[model samples]
Target: MNAVKTGSHAASTLEKTPVGDLVDGKGHSSGAEWLTRYSTSLMGVFGTPQRVLVRGAGCLVWDADGKEYLDLLGGIAVNALGHAHPFVTSVISSQLATLGHVSNFFTSPTQIALAEKLLALTHAPPGSKVFFANSGTEAVEAAFKLARRNGASPDGTTGKRTKIIALEGAFHGRTMGALALTAKEAYRAPFEPLPGGVVHIPFGDVAALEAAIDETVAAVFLEPIQGEAGVRPLPPGYLKAAREATTKAGALLILDEVQTGIGRTGKWLATEDAGIVPDAITLAKGLGGGFPIGALLTFGEQTSSLLAAGQHGTTFGGNPVATAAALATLHAIESQRVLENVAVVGDYLRTGLAAVDGVTEVRGEGLLIGFDLDAEVAPAVVTAGLDAGFIVNSPGPRTIRLAPPLVLTKDQTGTFLAALPAILRTAKDAQ
Candidate 1:
């Protein structure tokens, strides 16, 4: 075992031992060997592991083979301040040392502070409240419950307002309740008889949204930018329209900001871009800067009062360490002006990608970007990117998504831009 100091923090010691070497009393030196062990030990839901990443710092990660790649995906937009951000690391360590886990029967200062902070950041109205969860899916689950609770008659009944509306290309989460709201058939097909009454409408179609959302609807769910749907943003005025329709139809408007919130789009909430306040918003991903925390913010007294005591709860949600990490992540984002950096670097990448010969279109806001290729070679492009010391993702046959760290700089993006033409050429050749 070896001790390595990262960045300017010498007190922190990172173990340099290979993780594979410690498993099963056998030393597995390479990524392929560890992956072979992984197949037998882990479930196959996510397919093969892309790479056995050993360590990461800032916007870069090293694979088991010691190859370095610029991380453009940022752990699917979870690593907002980038991997191993020193401030977040220090806060977590300190919190763990002082007070780690406490059952939900009790609460800590950090938990209260985080809830207050989220409310303040979202500019939530008075009586707004926050419910902490362990991940984005859990937060969505809570929001689903909020919708159901809102639909209950004054005397408590179920079937009154049961229908929920979601868009054509939304990816809410994989949980049964969230899965019901998700628009993809492949994900929902396996788990049929899903909490019924979820209908999928065309993405960003105002008329369809207006028509689908009526008195019978309990809630209307939307993503400001449909990230898994090739980074497609809703048409302008779409969120405002949804808000209006839901309000008029007496339905709750819930925005899933799991991938787009917490400064991923240069704003605390992507809903801010549209200047409309929703009944509730689900957050995760960048909230704890990779420390695994999610939250559901319910706006106003009416919406916040829907879920009463004992209606929903979690065992490990809002623990001190997670909330402390979230506070540190928020502090770093503000003090370092990471949102401004996101705007500058995001524009640079979008413009450069559009100029590339093989790219047909580039879409997204801030650091959550996507582009289309001239051909259906997105998967090939992902492979070529990994091989060329860069990380990227393809959500569809012709679409590639890049949700780089909010702290990514223009210089780092220039490197990817310089390598992209060649990477695209290689992908096209492979296709």
Candidate 2:
């Protein structure tokens, strides 16, 4: 790893300075001026950019002014192999140059191989099928349609089986069908009258789930660990109970592994720990190693004859470049034993964070960890972390989430751990 030793004192103060001052008044090249242009050119969904990162390698990134940070968030857990892994880069570049994309009506070796690999990892038994999409939301949407198709009555009463059960704090995606399943009212309210019949239930409440799910429901979709809701893991018996209840109700069980899969939880799929096979599994995030790709995996006969033949399609869903990147990502994780590293480093991170004062709770497994402060000081801690040359995120006002790359080393974890106390102290002082 390359270390940007611009002196700790200077680096600490740099974060507090305006980007304009750091750029020496160079117009377009200046970070502030470029951001000004960005504000004019781009939409305001993310608000103002926090930091203008220029480059990255492994688990570290350098800002516009050459300040380095230990990136603990890992691009919101999308960079599973970390930034610019050699294998990922090699596969993407080679495939792009050779045969980048093709129409969905066509097939490619990488696409078939990636689907086969996902089926194998899912342990979905032979003859399982996979559908490719461009993001987690698309994967969920595909599975949602499939479930609706499977739940249709012999009397052709598909419309009545439209209700789908989702958990509170679950985030499937921003698209219409996926947005319908996400429970956050803020995200759904903007586009009110979203696809009707989607119901939200409290996460981990088996009784509530049992009560809500009935013959009217087409599917029950949930995140194994609610990522955007702050790394909240489901209770021990909750997942099994959900599967049983959904099965009894004749509803499909869909597990959204977008943020929790691909060794982030020290397992190929976090649902493996539960020992219950969902009717469908949606995956993305770490799957492409930063390239864009998503997959929906279904087992046995539940694959559903949904959408007929020409009902749904995407222009770049299963492009060769993206498929190759995912294939390489899977190969690298297996060959390098990255899941074991996630387990070891995750334990270290959890133990380290638990030792901090004012940390009321530490939850989650593997590298997808979250902790609560005594107060709503997460934003302050984020600022302090940036000052201390680290990167992190707050999923909520009181919860700090750390979903670093699986390639994060012991030394990298130690750096953030060692700086955490001072970061907390700084946050506390601000109050």
Candidate 3:
């Protein structure tokens, strides 16, 4: 028998591979056994593993058992250009080979370029500033601190307007500051004592917003479309009303575009045609096309100056690699004409879902869509979809959420529609 090498770039034989693996009777690793190991080692925050996904390409992924699925959730709207996109991978690889990262104390061209590009995309006014972070939660947390600073008095000690207003049914993030703004009781109760002085008002209700936002309010946070709450778009003129109310009350309007922005809605910004400028905006999810980057953009000196030196900092927020990946994502969105594709294919998906017998209503814009099931069988429907080699999410017991890659094609949309009838039937039969 020959000696098998382990670590240090050496290959190992079948019997010599280190631990953390399960072998069946035939001596092959199994996904089910791996799930058992995963459960034993990792916390059950997200519950049991689905398939132990191994590889992905385009709008498809394969599980540990080599089963393929058309990824409709896109990792919960994180994979903007789908998986292992060549353009993004090339940029990330090139940037990493050239300069992986530099400390925040130092800056890189990729980071600076991405900031400028994002500011331009927002059509931000002069003197706007972008604070980079690593995830959607961090971006919201940064904006939370910015709002607190805005509430501070001239000397930066006392405060006149210390309260922040967030909409009910909002899903900002899971961090303390972000969670404080989120309205879900289940998500907040376990993590009590959240950053205080946060108030929740009915989403898109002009009257509730007006009543809550007063001169003593620091900021009002709202999502253009409630992503995790079943993709409910704001009523017309709601954002305009919020802007007028906040401006009159001397409160800043912060839009959490974490899930809705970056061309997900077939627009550069979901709030593009709303005709109101947000004091600040927090963005993430699809920004890096799955590479992980978040940003807080403050408009004008009024909001930008709130975060002075040493106010907020992140170590890996704007690393050169992530920034480069983001740049590629943005460029691909444009050069690939993906926004146009989203409009055509998204409408197709929306219309198809609407035509389904079990679908009650379809809500959302562009590639981000959610539908209500006539019956309370969304989980069953999702399971049926998985069994049919499709990927979807049940955000609520009756809500099916789909935030697929922006590059989803009309053919893929047709394929999903073709398979949905049986999936819905399976759910109904189970019920």
Q: Residue by residue across 1-431, what tens digits does model 1's lDDT show?
A: 77765553543323455455545557646889878888999999999989999899999999989999999999999999999999899999989978999979999999999999999999999999999999999999999999898679766667589899998988999999999998899999999989988899998899999989888899998999999999999989999999999999999999999999999988888778587889999999999999999999999999999988888999999999999999999999999999899888888899999999989999999999999999999999999999999999999999999998899989999999999999999998997
- TM-score each candidate: 0.95, 0.91, 0.94
Error of 3 at 350 (Å): 0.7
Best lDDT goes to which candidate? 1
> What is the overall TM-score of model 3 with all chains considered together?
0.94
lDDT of 2 by residue, 1-431 (tens): 96665655676788687666676555326457568878998999999987888778999898877789999999988999999898889889789868987888799999999988888888886557888999999998897788678657665457567888899998899999899999888999999888877889988888898899887888889888998998998888888998898889878888899999999999999889797888888999999999889988887664544446765678889899999999999999999999999999999889988988889999998999999999899999999999899999998999999999999998989888888888999998997
**lDDT (Cα atoms) of all candidates against the true structure:** 0.92, 0.87, 0.91
Cα RMSD (Å) between model 2 and the true structure?
7.9
Query: For model 1, what is the alpha-carbon lDDT of residue 159?
Result: 55
**Candidate 2, which ten residues in sequence have the lowest lDDT sum?**
24-33
Number of backbone-clashing residue pairs for each candidate, in the order shown: 0, 0, 0
Q: Who wins the TM-score comparison?
A: 1
| lDDT of candidate 2 at residue 286, scale 0 to 100 | 96
